[model samples]
Target: MKNIFILAFLSVAIFSCGPGSKTIGDTSSSEIATNDTIKIANEALEYEVIIVEPGFDSWLISQPPRGYYGQTKLESKNRQFVAEYNTRVLNPTKYSRNLYTEQINYDAAVDYGYEVNYLLYNYFMYFQEKYNEKFIGGRN
Candidate 1:
């Protein structure tokens, strides 16, 4: 599947800038055996989103189900989050380079289905809570 988005762990060094930066973190056999990776694939759409952030899977499980939020709502929130996230990615000097390393390629014109939007929305929520970063105003 074509990789459309990925949230990988990056090194904490100051020089770790730009895409393709070295990934840091322990991926021991024990961690790999667990469901630490979240892969959302849509073969028909020829796109895939692989999120390898620890605790994301469990956090998602604790949240509401897929149908809890409408696709339109998810898409709206995703658009806002993606916009702010991309801005941060572009201005890494003003933000944490390690946290916002890559820009998310999300198009409002395309229909990414409900599952993808749901995961992306939740990922943003998980990201904010984990990193203590807020992309939008109001409640986190």
Candidate 2:
């Protein structure tokens, strides 16, 4: 059996080698709350998607609710986003290494369910808006 594991360690923090520090978004580093971790694991399928980023939980809640988009739509979008994100991961010099920390292994044939797809899709949107990045073309 092939074990499929997808772990995405994306962060909102900016590192600088200077006197002052840099931050993402409006809120400063101090004002921003603790990091949020959103994980969806399917024991039967032996695959999971873990997203650890600051303010993702609240941001996700503010977005459209589950079932807002069909599973196939979400999967399709996720596939595109994952492909672009992985490309960025490979070229850290071109892209921000902090944002694209790791590569995500998303299989199109695998049925990751609604919950997993929903969270994964939202996370990509959040990352794009927050970091000012456009993974795929067209609408987010």
**Best candidate, TM-score-wise?**
1
lDDT of 1 by residue, 6-107 (tens): 223323343466456446654565676466787888888788998888788878889999799999999999999999999999997899889988989999
Which pairs of residues collide in model 1?
A: none
User: What would you estimate as the lDDT of candidate 1?
Assistant: 0.83
| Alpha-carbon RMSD, candidate 1 | 17.4
Provide the clashing-pair count of each candidate structure. 0, 0
As a whole number from 0 to 100, the lDDT of residue 32 in candidate 2 is: 46
Q: Write candidate 2's Cα lDDT for 58-107 as tens digits.
A: 88878888888999999999999999999989998999888778899899
| Shift in Å, residue 41, candidate 1 | 1.7
TM-score, cand. 2: 0.72
* Span of 10 residues, lowest total lDDT, candidate 2: 3-12
What lDDT is reached at residue 126 by model 2? Answer: 86
TM-score of each: 0.75, 0.72
